[model samples]
Target: MAASGDGISKSDQLDSSPSSPSPASDCAFSSSQSSYMSNAPDPRPDIPSPLENGSMKHHVNGDSGVNGINGQMKATKVGSRSWVGIYESFLMKNASQIASVESTLQHLTYLFPAKFKDAEIASEVVYSALGILGLYHDTILARALSSCPSSAKYQPSLHTRYTRHFTTRNSAYRTIAYMLVVIQKTELLNEIMSRRHGGQRGQHTAILGIESIKATCRLALLRISGTRTLVTPPIPERDIDPNVLDQDGPITHAEAAEEDGDYWMMPRTGQKMPQLKGETDVTRFLMKKVLLPDDVAPSPKLIRPLTTADGRIKEILYILRPLVYALLALLAARLRASKRFKGHYEKVVINWMPWVVGFALEYVCRDGIIDSLSAEGGIRAALTKITGLEKRELEKRSNSMWWWTLRGQFYDSITKPILDKMIKKAENIPLLNLVGLYITDYQYLAETYHFSTSTL
Candidate 1:
């Protein structure tokens, strides 16, 4: 921004005029060539000696200095271009990896969702959000991580804002959520809020109210037009036998449970060892605790009946079950950023409650995850990923599950506190202290940016 004594700014230093180099360029050239005169060169008969001809010496020195300056300028230009190219290449690679991870997670949710968690729908809209003129995912991510320490530039991104927009909620909820997450860093969302509602907190309250109603109406329409209870095909347990990963031939599956026994996962023996259940170590314990297997590891049934009731029973509660839960989910999704809640208790509740409720609903219906290998990724998924068409249906089916993690409350509340204590203890250790620093940065990133916090 500002430059010292000579008054040439950073921009001028990088792109100075050819005839007049900046002070930095001049100083660099001087220091680099300071040894030039002392270095010995082979004597040439045609060259005039400085001692014999003073004017000839000045002429040669002046020409040599001009040529060197011109060369330095040319090299700087080339280097700048090269640097930009490298930066872009790395950015695209990161985006691709992000998309891939999101896709995998979404499918995994459908196939092997957390004990209580429902399968994630097509939620890969992130990759599509890229290519925006001034927006970059990494830049937004950096801002999010930095904001956790202070909410000075932060805004509670509520789901109500975009839920009314059918195409967007279906496609770009994550991107839109992400855009809101980094509202302060990139002024686009800020400008939008200001333009629409006079930029006042009070002014926007009415919009939220209106949006809440619209969202309720939309969900009502979906419920009325849809089935009374959520139903899906049962999910299988194991994808393939781990022992088969070491083999070189096609594996066999039980003919009776062909669809339930296998999945589309690659069998790689590299960098992996069998997970022994006998180990008492923390790592093994954590690996077991992190994932819980499905309740019924039953053989695949061709036609599973999810509903058991034969009809009748005109009960109010039963009739309103979908609406009540759907509304509660909307409320949870919209309430956090309202500033009315004094604590993040609601956040933790939203993160896990719907999941628990989902486990029950699916349990009663006898339906689990519906299988689909091909699904289009959403904007979040693409930036975060890209899923399949049927994949979108999975996300739709995931409705009513507490997706409170969208704002990343669990990481900040539960994971952060634990990791913070661990990092502090690690801070005093030898090699562990170095690892602490990396984890600390990553912790902040995960806290700030909830894009990777998938609904799956």
Candidate 2:
């Protein structure tokens, strides 16, 4: 048990292995060393073996040899699987259905972060996003574009952000081709034109935000117009009768049959060919000027003089006739309102004058030709004479049993007889003097503000 000079006890020296050591003592020493090594960190720090404390092995700042190898492997596996299924599903859908799938993919793409695993997959994403906003189809494109102006007003920043991201001219030709194939091409072109005219917001931004959008729309418009998609169908030939005489020209038997055949051929033919016969005074004047006299034969030698006279008369009637009638009517209305004409004269001015004037106007407008005028014209004959209204119309009025029952006989006997008597009385009155009085009274009234006169 005594220590030797080399600082080894005699017992330790005897226990040391020298050529052959005792196996039991060596085994006991190795077992004690193994027990001490159990609490130390592992030599392989790259693997994610749990720490002695049972905590996850962190990748950084380790006292050990390495870190994060297992974490890197896990991330690689996840990233590899990311977007793989999305890419496969996206490719299987058609363009119309792609929009719905694209929305989900976009959300996934945002939620699950990963680099595009393949170029084809990236392009498919781009294509799907474009389709979601209807960039690929014309009908949907129109709806999208039409709604853009409104969206630009509210959430303008967000609107601009997405607008610039989506719209590209690479599919311009394809878009135009699709729109042309639709039967409603004209309506679609009109919608685009109206959108252009309606104006767009942010169109002039320095970023060319809406301006670039308008340019794309203009390109589509140009494509449509250039292809003549807006061209209307050709009008079919129509049968125009050269010998038609007057506003109420009689239809010949053969002409009527032909018209019936045409109407039978095309049900909507009458809707296309509108008739405006004598609906206006200008039309009436033109008709009269163009129509030939039935009593006189058309002579080429007299054509020049007749045309000049007809034009002169038409101009005079178009200008002066309406003015003269307006003036007379105004004078009659004023006279009816005057204090002197309130009682007995009120009836004559209000009721009688209008009836007489109306009848006279109808006669002049309808049968005022020189040949129709004769010296033997009396009040009774004038009342009985045919004018614009036919006898059939008068008979129809007389034979209206329901109207007679509803309105009573006062309109038929009293009102009609009085109106006829007034017409007869008004026939003898000189129209020249009445016109002169109107002019004189008009002048006197105009100067009344300057001087008091007994002209009233």
Candidate 3:
């Protein structure tokens, strides 16, 4: 066949057209024919080929090499999806569960010995669960505190319940104390106080709330004194029954005279008792003169209670007035000395003036300083001269500038209103002592160094 210009090669025509039979099909046909001609058993096993098995092993080992890079791409896509689902389901739902957990804690409180027995275990479980769930919150803690009774019904058997199951017993006591003082929960606190007197385990638990108990007592006393009405139960007086004799019988006049001696008699035999010589002896002598017996009878001296108001006032003034006068005199002298020295002394005095004033006022008022001044008198004097220096030092030590900032907040929130009303209504009544009570309370707070600026 001579080649024409068209050429028309059979292989070229087959490759270009869809109607052509494939080479792969021809090869399969040929292999089948060869197998048929051999008539021998096929050599290939029914098990996977060595090449196929090797490819699977590479996939299992997470190897892209040999298996090709496409397999690793498939795996990374699957893993990323799983991680995203887990994070969303666990971490994102935590905020919604906190309230439910807090409610569970409150409900658990009422269950008695059963819960008490495994209280610590229960607490651990709860905390662990909450942490795992990521639901722990401050509101849960505050809710627990507010709901727990300041004075629960006194049940001796429930002592174990409180001791064991109350997870934050100390914090609970402190919170209750703060609330009672803040809210003035007198009746509830009184019940707590009465329960305290029963000498039971429940009371012991309640006594953990001691500040509340004390505040209740003080408020009751003040109310009674202000009203002059015995509305509240009387504070129990310590009884000294005459029939209850000492081991040596009732304190005898002769024995008392021997032990305490006759201060005014000037020693019957003029044999000066060595003991009756000092300032203490002089004080005893003066007391004897003022408290002389009316009759010759040497029976035990009965001390008369002061009946006259003037006499009580005079006694108080006698004890306090001299100290006040001395302090005032000292302050006046310092002022006068500062005036004489003028510029330098003025600066020195000014630097120490606050402390000097603070100390002098504290001495006169019998109050402790908020910040303890240096014991070295000179340094204290120097520091006190600067205005507000004492207060600044106190703020520094206590780390509470809020005290200075919120100076009158407690009074404004609580004391001042009550005092103004009491003053307006009970002007005739001697309620000045109530002011003294406030002063005493303030002094106590200062002495304890509890100047909580946040509280103010």
Candidate 4:
């Protein structure tokens, strides 16, 4: 917030000053110089002429303009740093909620074990999601470990279980989310490259063009045709030639010295393929399942609409987004209510109530006929806890399993089918087509509903 050393911030100056002068203003002579040459009366004798005095140094050689730009750049850097700090702090503060969401999501991944065809594939999906989210790495692990409670309820075994689940799921959910984002980015890259090249393909434009996408599809097929594991040639240790290195020092190997740049390089029988930018092994695995090219017909065996494992996994996460938000909101409410924190009641209600309501609505939709039965069971439990007279009797008589059975049936018969249909429908639309529709819809809605009614 400090001044830009020109007496005021560039932002303040821009706001306070008039619009910049027209180009014609550069051709005009100084009024004072013109008056002096014409022998006209001095407009103000008391005023020091800018040409004689150094007070107008700001105007000399466009130094003011340069200073303004520099100030703006500095302000931008400061703003970026502040924004990053705020985002990191937000992530840290919500680590527990994030951990819970991830744990639940991983458990949900188990629900679709059949969808993945095997336990290993389902586990792969889970791990892929984790890797994408950076949870597989130490990035979120430290935060999660620090935020967990060190109370009696969280015994060593319980803590270990919690940490294990947190690490596994947090990364998995993040991975799935990141893959969706990457799909959009890659699609955009493809479009831009195609527009620039107008169909004629070259190596540089290949990644962003149709050729790259076709190459990816072909690569995916080659991968699917073989076992998932890559077979590398075994390196045999041999006595190094003393002449290989003249001095007793570490030496770079010839193979290590070659920096591979072409990501689209096809895998040869005994050679390794160059790694794709912004991709992990897990990410690459998932992308191979669904990445389709504009020119090629999508393979029936590959992921289509909602039929493929990747599509189903992504869709499941999409449907669960509301639950994630609900969990976060509830966690935030607990944080706000804790003795250490202070916040407005209005804010708590404003931020928390909608999530609570949405969660309730979703629960009702999911449970259908079972919602009332579950509510009844919850109320009965609460009453028994308060009375304490028939706690043992109530526990013995509780029909929780009956309610759960009904809920399960509702999910299997109604909710799951509807979600499956929706996922399938989504698959019919190309990824790029979906993105374009979303952007167009967003723009239309913003223009129609915005206070300014901006057409842009």
Give the top-scoring candidate (TM-score). Answer: 1
Instruction: Give the runs in model 2 whose Cα sits over 4 Å from its true position.
Output: 1-322, 365-456
What does candidate 4's lDDT look like per residue over 1-456, in tens digits?
121221221111211213333232111221212223345343345654444666556676856755665466555544545554444445444433554566577666534423334443444346446534533223433322223221111112211222233224455433433333344223333333343456433322332233233324323322332211101100111111212211222332321233534333445655535444344543633333332221122112111122234323332332343344334534544555664544577555644453455344433332221222234466454343221112321232233223221122233355446645655567567885554444443333222211111100
Cα lDDT tens digits, model 3, 127-168, are 444432322233222222222221111111111122122223
For model 1 the local lDDT of residue 118 reads 21
lDDT of each: 0.34, 0.31, 0.33, 0.34
TM-score comparison, 2 vs 3, better candidate? 2
What RMSD does each model have against the real structure?
23.7, 42.6, 42.5, 31.3
After superposing all C-alphas onto the true structure, candidate 4 shows an RMSD in angstroms of 31.3
TM-scores for all predictions:
0.24, 0.17, 0.16, 0.18
- Model 1 C-alpha RMSD vs. true structure (Å) is 23.7
RMSD of model 2 against the true structure = 42.6
Q: How does model 1 score by TM-score?
A: 0.24
Sort order, TM-score high to low: 1, 4, 2, 3
Which pairs of residues have clashing backbones in candidate 4? Answer: 129-171, 129-172, 130-171, 130-172, 133-175, 305-427
